[model samples]
Structures are given as C-alpha cells and as structure tokens.
Target: MQAIGLIETRGLTPALEALDAMCKAANVRMAGFKRVGSGLITVIVEGDVAAVTAAVDAGIAAYPKTGGQLVSSNVIPRPHADLARMLL
Candidate 1:
C-alpha cells in the first residue's frame, strides 16, 4: 500500500460509521480493525496516498454523526515496509 489511514473511535458504532464513510468517499480498501478494550476501536484502510488522505478526512467528518468520540485519525504516506507488513 502506498498509504494507510487509521480512524480510532471510542465505540464500535462510530468506527463502523467512519469505515463506511472512508470506503464510500475514496478508492480505499479495508485492511482490518482492532478493538483495544474500553470500547475503543480502530479502523484501518489502505490505498494510494491521495485516496487514503481523502478517506481519512471523510471518516473524521462522519465520526461525530454517530455520537461517538473520535480518539484520533492519521494517514501515513510511504510507510516503511516493515510497518506495512506488521499492519497488514
């Protein structure tokens, strides 16, 4: 992947909402997700840099609609090979 996007939310519902918005707003693919306990969920997406950026933005924008707090969001362009491997 040229880039990876992550959206972390306080609840699964908000994370799902973010994932839905991300996928619909860009040509990105779901990598996977993890629940880190305490109701925190993180959604991951993979795509080209531009796509990832757009997807993350869309996810962030849609997050509040679900009434779930967003923990954080990030887009890493040209991530290290090892990092990508570990994430995938």
Candidate 2:
C-alpha cells in the first residue's frame, strides 16, 4: 500500500460515518477495522498517499456530526513494508 489512513472514534456510529465519508471523499479502499473495548472503534483505509490523506481528513470532518467523540486519526505515507503487511 502506498498509504494508510486511520480514524478512531468513541462509538460505532461515528466510525461508520467516518468510513462512509472517507470512501466518498477519495479513492481509498477499506482495509479493516478494530474495536478496542470501551466503545472505541477504528476504521482503516488504504490508497495512494494523497488519497489516504484526503480520506482521513474527510473522515475527521464527518465524524463529529454524529455527536460522537473522535479519539485520534493518522495517515502514514509510504509505510514500511512490514507495517503495511501487518496492517493491510
């Protein structure tokens, strides 16, 4: 993968919202997601660096509209092969 974007939220609803927005905003593909307990959930997307960055930004913008708290967000460009292997 050229890049990976992640968006974490306090609830499933917001996470889903973010994922939808991300997909709509860029040419990114859903990688996977994880629920880490305590209602924390994360959505992952993969694409080219610019696309991933745009998707992450779109996700962050859409998340708060769900009235849920955002935990964190990140975009990793040209990630190490090992990290990409593990994440993708």
**Winning model by TM-score:** 1
Candidate 2 lDDT over 1-88, as tens digits, reads: 8998999899999999999999999999999998989999989999999999999999988877799999999999989999978876
Candidate 2, run of 10 with poorest lDDT: 79-88
Model 2 compared with the native: what TM-score?
Answer: 0.95
User: Per-residue lDDT tens digits of candidate 1, residues 1-88?
Assistant: 7999999899888999999999999999999899889999999999999999999999999887898899999999999999988877
TM-score quality measure for candidate 1:
0.96
Off by over 4 Å in 2: none
Worst 10 residues of 1 by lDDT: 60-69
Question: For model 2, what is the error of residue 35's alpha carbon versus the real structure, in angstroms, after optimal superposition?
Answer: 0.9
Candidates in order have lDDT scores of 0.94, 0.93
lDDT for model 2? 0.93
Model 1: residue 52 alpha-carbon error in angstroms: 0.4
Q: Estimate the TM-score of every prediction.
A: 0.96, 0.95
lDDT of 1: 0.94
